[model samples]
Target: MTQLPLLEQAILVLAALTLLASFSMLAQSRLTSAIHSFAWQGVMVAAATALVAAVGHAHHLYLSALLTFSLKGLLIPWMLHRLVRRLNMEREVENIAHPALVVLAGALLVILAYWIALPIERLELASTRNIIAISLAIVLLGLWLMIARRQVVTQVLGFMSMENGLFLAAVASTRGMPLVVELGIAFDVLVAAVLFGVFFFHIHESIESLDTGKLTRLTEEEPA
Candidate 1:
């Protein structure tokens, strides 16, 4: 069997690294560490995109790489760190479920992705089926993270993970999306993050915690 090219291998490896870091985030007990892992994952994705762009001569992918590096890698992580500090949420990263269970769920997601990808093995693309499956797993795991956590910050991280998965899928299917589309996505994400940061502060000020249950309680108590 002919092997995947070096560029293809690099892309697949980096995608795997991103997925692994996301799973690690599910199990990490400290907010700072989860933030660091997320940053590293972003850098890995950016590097992979750059590698693919270089190998395949996709000029627009360079912009995608830049977007990943600047937005996901640097800006978002820094903002999250500052947001945590400002909101005094720089403590433990609690999981509503057991850490062992969380890890198991992530593993199942990966297995499911690979299993589903097995049916589409005929296409001669660079990691097409595997990457798509992994991307879907990433999206589902991110949703799981949101459901299995009480903290607003963790839910925000889950949303970011979903976005990462979408980007990964785009890369796998098309090598890269257009620069304008990537830019638009970046803009929307930035705006959403800023809005959420403000909302975080408000939630903290009102309840002295970043838990979603507290917000639900607030909603329940309000007069209809």
Candidate 2:
């Protein structure tokens, strides 16, 4: 048995922390806490990208890390916090229908991710190949977060988190995306955040709530 290099070990630790942050977002009831968890997840992902850059000597990944830390880690979360403040939802607490069941489902998804990544792991394409499983698990957890949470803001958080997982997958599998592509993605994400803010204000003004369930009821009540 051979010991992994220190940098690789640190990357693995960051990967694990990113996965835990995903679970934290899933189980969080308070919207603010969930947002904080998502922010930390971004920070971990940026750190992992930086470590990968160092290990592979991919100078571009360092830029990607800085971009990730700025956009995902700082800008997006700040936008969300501002939106929450404006909406007066700072203290809003969402009730997960079945907390334990949702967490168990998330655990199953992690197992599924590992099973799915087994074939890819065998390829040994990169030193960071094993991180693929964790990346996939984060993606699955993000999807689960969207499905299990009813609040529109929570769904947006889940969506952003899913993007984080995809970004991590790229880092783990391909060592990072082209700089132009990452820039395009960052711009698109910023646009989406602004759009979501506008949408939230519109929805709140029209219906006085951000609950998707209420939106369904509203649609049902409207005359055809």
The candidate that wins on lDDT is 2
Put down candidate 1 lDDT per residue, 1-224, tens digits, no spaces: 87978777888888889899888778876887888888887888788778778877888888889889999899998999999987667876665557788789889988887787666555746554578888888888889888887888888888888888888888777787877798899899999989989998888888778877776664546565
Model 1: clashing residue pairs?
A: none
* Ten contiguous residues with the weakest lDDT in model 2: 215-224
How many pairs of residues collide in each model? 0, 0
List model 2 lDDT by residue over 14-110, tens digit each: 9999999999998999989999999999999999999999999999999999999999999999999999998999999997898999999999999
Cα deviation of 90, candidate 2, in Å: 0.4
What's the lDDT of the predicted structure labeled candidate 2?
0.92
Model 1 misplacement above 4 A = 218-224
- Residue pairs clashing in model 2 are none
